[model samples]
Target: MQGKAGFWNLSNKLTLFRIGVIPVVALLLLSPGRAPNLVAAALFLVAAITDTLDGYLARRRGTVTPLGKLLDPMADKLLLVTALIFLIPLGRVPTWAVAVIVARELAITTLRGIAASRGVIIAASWLGKVKNLLQLAAANLLILHHPYFSIDPHRLGTYVLYLALFFTVWSGLDYLWRYSRL
Candidate 1:
């Protein structure tokens, strides 16, 4: 019933819900208020949960669809990209880092497209998953910028974000190397 499955399916619906949450998160984060940061982090956490749930349900229930596959990654990218971009103004993160992350993502995405057009399958690597987790954790920590329990979240998040950037570039290169083989 894969053909019968569409946007109405649980997996696809979760994907769409995640996508919808992106703008809300951005709006909440960007709003000038004391609570925006915490709110943004909470919304982002929910989105991340949806990302996990959707993928799990898709494979578990045999309801995978091309749309779900595309939307899921897109939602993740948008969430990460939005967070990084928004944080630039807040000075919690550097513009250069965001620029580098964005550039690598663009390059890898383009390479993936080219590889797909040439009938080459370049699946996500373990590094990519780690990069994502690092990015998500960094973003959340940065969002909660203030100190908590004698720990400077901003400083810690910066270090993690830098690591995410390292893996991002590494994974992009790996993907390009894969594409070149095709």
Candidate 2:
């Protein structure tokens, strides 16, 4: 396990793989064809799955390096933000919602940086975890953009995005409040 403390861990490689997929997913998303969109959705799903997998591996292996801590969140931001940015021109998502989510992410990251510099650790709250799950669900639903029987996935995705936005703000505030106490 002590050997796992270095940067050359399996979990770190998975995190890097997630980052590498971001551009492929983005470029594939921009292809002017339905097949490419479907492919993009599939790639995005794989990348999203890696998020959970990497974290699980890191914790279970006790190989959570500082680099993993940085790269993990960076990979998450790049994947989701890239999807949202590319989807904007396609009119598949609300720009204001995207803006709110991005803003919250930036704010929270800045807060984390400040906390880390001050030797204060503020772990993620339950609300933040739920927000991430909802964001992934929303991104998948929007990417699929297919109607399932009586349900319009696009509409449901929009609602999910709104809920994610609410939690993003709520969790950001919670983090800020928690940091203030420390």
TM-scores of the candidates are 0.92, 0.91
- Per-residue lDDT over 12-75 for candidate 1, one digit per residue giving the tens place of the 0 to 100 score: 8888887888888778777875488778888888888887788888888888888777888888
Worst 10 residues of 1 by lDDT: 1-10
Which runs in model 2 stand beyond 4 Å of their true positions? 148-151
Model 2 lDDT tens row, 27-94? 88778766777778888889898998998898888988888888999999989998998888888898
Count clashing pairs, candidate 2: 0
Judge candidate 2 against the unseen true structure and give its global Cα lDDT, from 0 to 1.
0.85
Provide the lowest-lDDT 10-residue window in model 2: 1-10
- Candidate 2: Cα lDDT at 66: 82
Candidate 2 RMSD computed on C-alpha atoms after optimal superposition onto the true structure: 1.9
Name the top lDDT candidate.
2
Work out how many backbone clashes candidate 1 has.
0
